[model samples]
Target: EDQVTQSPEALRLQEGESSSLNCSYTVSGLRGLFWYRQDPGKGPEFLFTLYSAGEEKEKERLKATLTKKESFLHITAPKPEDSATYLCAGREKGGGNKLTFGTGTQLKVEL
Candidate 1:
């Protein structure tokens, strides 16, 4: 079974504060690591796709990195608009596009 777990179910950040959230995963075989940002009552917005260990991607105020067994989403100098639920999903070998997602880490940035 492919499983994903995220730490700090919720996070509170002040404006300009930076931090990194962890996503731990277990899978039969890794196909891809996906990072998504979801707002309240909305679908997730794709952030990055990591296919192998040591892979990384960045955008705006976020950077995502993948390793053999885990991934990290680093938020830099976040603003109130950066607040959202960060979700991690893994596509296992032969699993197709069906992603197994973590519960997610909800982030709240206060000005």
Candidate 2:
């Protein structure tokens, strides 16, 4: 079975503050990892897809990085618009499109 754990289940930050969210995972055979951002009452929005350790993706104020056992989402100088729930999911090799996900990290940015 594949499992994912996310730290700091919720976070509150002032505008322009920076922080990082963590996602730890254990899988039978890791194939890829994904990151997403979600708003209240809405589906997740795709942020990045990391296929191997040392891989990274970035957009605006967010950056996603992957490793063998964990992934990190770094938020730099966040704004109120950046407030949202960030999620990470992992796909195992031969799992056939099945992805295991962590609960999520709820981030609130105040001006």
Candidate 3:
């Protein structure tokens, strides 16, 4: 079974709109939860990493928070440039470097 899952298969928003994206995961000995942003035809750009429940990170208009079995990416007043697919992956202790990724959340911010 997939260890990681993200909700809201797709999202459409106007510039300056705010929203939150959810990521749910089930992992034993979870080492960390990672977030990345991917633009069309481009590789994922690393965003943040959560090491434990209650850990949070922020960059510009994006904020990521984690819990024992879930994570959340909060977007505050997103702009058009923020449009992309957000992906989440999990790393388990002693599970090697390989990570299982979620299907990803597609976000489109229009003018």
What's the lDDT for residue 84 in model 1? Answer: 97
Q: Could you tell which candidate, 1 or 2, scores higher by lDDT?
A: 1
How well is each residue in 39-74 modelled by candidate 2, as lDDT tens digits?
999999988999989999999999999888899999
Listed per candidate, the RMSD to the true structure in angstroms reads 0.9, 0.9, 1.0
* lDDT values, one for every candidate: 0.93, 0.92, 0.92
Cα TM-score of candidate 1:
0.96
Pairs that collide, model 2: none
Candidate 2: where are CA atoms >4 Å away?
none
TM-scores of the candidates are: 0.96, 0.96, 0.95
Question: For model 3, how does the per-residue alpha-carbon lDDT over 39-96 read when each residue is reduced to its tens digit?
Answer: 9999999999999798899999999999888999999999999999999999866745
Residue 46's lDDT within candidate 2 is 89
Top candidate (lDDT) = 1
Q: Give candidate 1's whole-model lDDT.
A: 0.93
| lDDT score, candidate 1, position 100 | 89
